[model samples]
Target: NESVWTADQNEEMSNTSASPDSVSLADVSAEKATQGSDTDLEVEDPEKAFAGVMGAELYLEACRLTEVVPVSHFIQNLSKPYVNLNHHGLGPKGVKAIAIALVSNGTITHLELEDNCILAEGAIYIAEMLRENSSLQELNISNNHLDTAGAEAIASLLLDNMSYLHALQLSGGLYALKQSHCVCTFVSLQGNYQVKELDLSHNGFSEKGGQLLGQMLARNTTLEILDLSWNHLSRKGTVALGTGLRGNGALKILNLSWNGIGNEGALALGEALKVNNVLVHLDISNNQINNEGAKNLCRGLEVNGKLKILKMANNPLTVEGATALLASVRKNHNCMMEEINISNVLVNETFIKLLDLVCRMRPELDVIHGEVEGCITKIPKQHPNPMKVIQKYLKEHNLQLWDFFRNIDKDGNMKIPVAAFRRAMMQQQNIPLDRVQIGELVRQLDRHRTGIVDY
Candidate 1:
């Protein structure tokens, strides 16, 4: 493969070096010749960076993608985790070249090809690459005109090689009912068994595709995060998703904001959450779910026990409705509440009491309320214990302890009681811990015998 690429680079060098401005790209070594500028990037081995870029350039040129990024930039950043080739007008031809390069390159894990206009033909090449590549984890192909054919092909790639792909971003128009149905069809028949995240935001979706997604969600246990925000999934579509959630035991984070899901849709989801023991993070922000919907949602949340994070920004939540929701969670002794976003909602005289409750229950809980800058004022922290410092560090990095908490608290409450700690950890994150060991750890955290720890 290197030999073939060298030959192509040699041909490209000879053909384009007619002017003094053109550098001998094939002969470039020791230093990358930027266009009258020196590269600011530092590398452990300059020689390795040179080789990486040369190989990428040769492979790209061989596939007739001449109008690509500068070789110097690619060399300096070849070993980085992500490659952003957005807005480069990488049409079908360029997309094919990139696909070929990606198959051989092992370092790049996240590839962004947004707005590249890589139509159906280009998508085929990408699918072929996905079949062969092993390092890629995320692919952003948004704003590419890869219609139904392209959609089916990418969907096939996800199903065939599920381990390599954890995230797929298909955000933009052209993701209507037809495209959604096409994607869901592949997922159901073939199976995207290992993908954890899927973002299809800003697509002009309707209920036909929503039903398809519901059908797929009913069985897929591997998917953990889903974003369908900024769409047109009104009550009809959201109801179907709710029905699917009723039986789903895997999904943890869901974003359905800006979808115009009115009170009816909110009611449906609230009812579903009553039986749902998995979902933890939910975003229904900017939906038309008014005071009635808020009350209904609280009714479900109070009885259900898994939710920890809820975002309701830009909803028309009146004083009565907002109070009802908060009161319901508090009265239920919900310690799992981590964050609540209620920006742009009407807050009445109960605002102070609401803030005080949140402050006492969760000193670390982030509350985004009202439109003022820094609406959530907090008191300065007291001196922390060494255990608290260690916990904070672990939480910051999402280390094993935090993962354990997340796994055990499947209902999204962010906090776990002392009694259920061991069982939940083993059942959720696959950590094998005995009752005694978990008891000791809980004792270390719960010094005052509060029976709770801020996870």
Candidate 2:
């Protein structure tokens, strides 16, 4: 995020996994149970029958799809705590059979039923099992044909008196992710006080649905992470959510990216941050937030303390809003953010200035962004205001670009030696950057791949 790199800072960051629990099984053995790894017991196929799916075509389908003969062969042991039947060609018949077994079994805590081609009735059976189950903690029911009614039925599990469900991951396949039944699909989960993590990303729930989910957040106490990305939440919907988020405590991370939430929506969320103390991370990228909205968010930070990471990349913020946001963190002790991302928001010059200011003023808070466009696009060779760009960028870090350039300006012209720029950054600002870091900065300023940055 910044030029200062630690010895052990893994740079990769993204959340897209194939399995419900995409954790490493390395060093998984009885001797090292406390060494920090997800260890699920693996046993030989049990001979006992799963009477539920014994004679059904679902069993035949599972057997044919997977060469393991019987799909239930792996889940037959009543003591086994993990049941993963993902992509096993299980339809309604298969899901109902498994549901029948789960109704009586009380051992498994994690269940994966993704991409099984199950429909409404199958979802109903699973919902019934949720009504009675108590030991289960994670449920992955994505990629099934649970139409509107089926989805609502499962959603009502939140209202069930006995359902102790925690994490509900409905991040489904292409069809399921795009198909939404309407507001009812999620309104049933409103006021739910049990689940902690809910992933509704890639779904098509409308703004009305988003509003209802907001109402749920107001009443919920256990929910911590909520992912509603690409759900078409507009400003009105987000404003409604802000009403709930204003005082919410359990919620910490909110991902509303890839939606239609505009400047008003961002402002509303910023207002929420002013009063909400629990939320620490927020991702509102790809929205319509502009300069005013960015300023409003900065104002929120001026009074807020809990928010640690603000990811606002891909918005339409200009230099005015970007600098204000950075300055708020710099001026106010209340807004001690660990990371701020304004990537792809402003132009080449403006972005450089804002980035440099944050890097110098708050060395602990890393600013994340991408290369500037002008440098990348190779603006006019006889650029008129190149000096202004460089000076503004340097001023942000409390350094004079002219002075730094004068020492290396061999011809006494405005142009400076590109090789000396890296050394100047270290000498003037005490920011020691290696080749990788210096090369990255040069790319931002040398958009045209030019060897020298005249500005």
Candidate 3:
């Protein structure tokens, strides 16, 4: 399941100097970087500050610097684990110091530098390093304002590098779904043959980028997980991706949450699911799907028994939609689903009764009814106040408030909707809502509803 791949870095050295206004971290050395000497690896008494610098120095040596000191770059020395510097008061230098450590650290597999205020230059420096490094597996540099130029720099590296990374998380980067339409469609995943997990959630890469990536997935053979959550991929984008899935066989997990995909998109994906058997998990929460979309997906669920998890908690699913989905689940005996999250979806007595019956029939299935009472209340269904009922249940079950509320969609403007309600239900039920499912539902619920519901 885990493997390491490698390649040499290839790029022309531009005389291009980073902007003076840009925040500068220490620079890398122009030598084949090495780990601390065998002697330095062990120390009886190591000072905290000195340990940080030593870690920095070791980073430079390990990366094999090609430039001299003061090379118009970041960190000059390294010693500590790159990820441990996530403390308060870490400035650009501190950040750069950490990145330097990451670029060379052999033990670190995941580096999350999202929202660290890293600019194009910093990104370029790291991009150059990542092009050659093989140990790091997951890199998250999202929300750092990487424009097209910055994005392109990393893309260029990805276009050539034989990296060991199977997962790359760059959500909420400079690309905004609608805004990134004009950006050059140069981002490529063709070279990342071994990558299995990719999260481009909240980046502005709209349908165009989605299409590009979908096409890439069709040709690439190793990827099994792709998360395009929160990129506002509409029906057009969903259609484009569905076309790719028709032929792709390696993918097992696909997350397209919060993309405003309506019934049309759901239908397209459902059609693909009917024919494609490899995918095991699909998250389509917090989109524009309503009862009609749910019915389409339900049709697929009835016919496609391979999917073990189907998330449609959010979007516009109502009582009708929930019943539709439940009907499909009940009809499909081959559905190996062990969990279902239907939080905040206006789940009335109709849906709740059906779900309870399903649970009774299938003892192995776990069902979450986050705010089921509240959803029921919306349509004059028979139920007490959802919040009160939930509170009482938690009290009876000895569930903590945090655990109860962790699943509620904290992103909605109004009360319980499907997505928010679904996730909260999952948290309380102790079922794992796919990360992408939670991410999408979280964005659709009101903030006030977050972190309060319990078992």
Which candidate's lDDT is highest?
A: 1
Error of 3 at 418 (Å): 22
lDDT of 1 by residue, 118-140 (tens): 77767777887787778889988
Better of 1 and 2 by TM-score: 1
- TM-score leader: 1
Give me the runs in candidate 3 sitting further than 4 Å from their true place: 1-55, 58-104, 176-191, 348-353, 370-455
* Rank ordering of all candidates by lDDT, starting from the highest: 1, 2, 3
In candidate 3 the C-alpha lDDT for residue 32 amounts to 24
TM-score-sorted candidate list, best first: 1, 2, 3
> What residue runs in model 2 are displaced by over 4 Å at the alpha carbon?
1-69, 72-81, 172-190, 346-357, 372-455
Error of 3 at 384 (Å): 19
Q: Give the TM-score of candidate 2.
A: 0.64
Question: Could you give candidate 3's per-residue lDDT for residues 1-455 as a string of tens digits?
Answer: 00011001101111122322222122222122233322112123434213455444654442332221221122421222244222122223333334555544566666666675555655665676575566778777767766666676766665665567777766666664433542224434353576688777777566677677667667667778888888777888888888788778898999888888799988888888777788888888888888898888776778776776677666666777777877887888777665556675666656667776775455445455455556543665343444555557778888875655543536533244433354345445443343334434444344564422222
Model 3, position 374: C-alpha lDDT score: 61
Q: What is residue 444's positional error in candidate 2, in angstroms?
A: 20
lDDT for residue 77 in candidate 1, whole number 0-100: 54
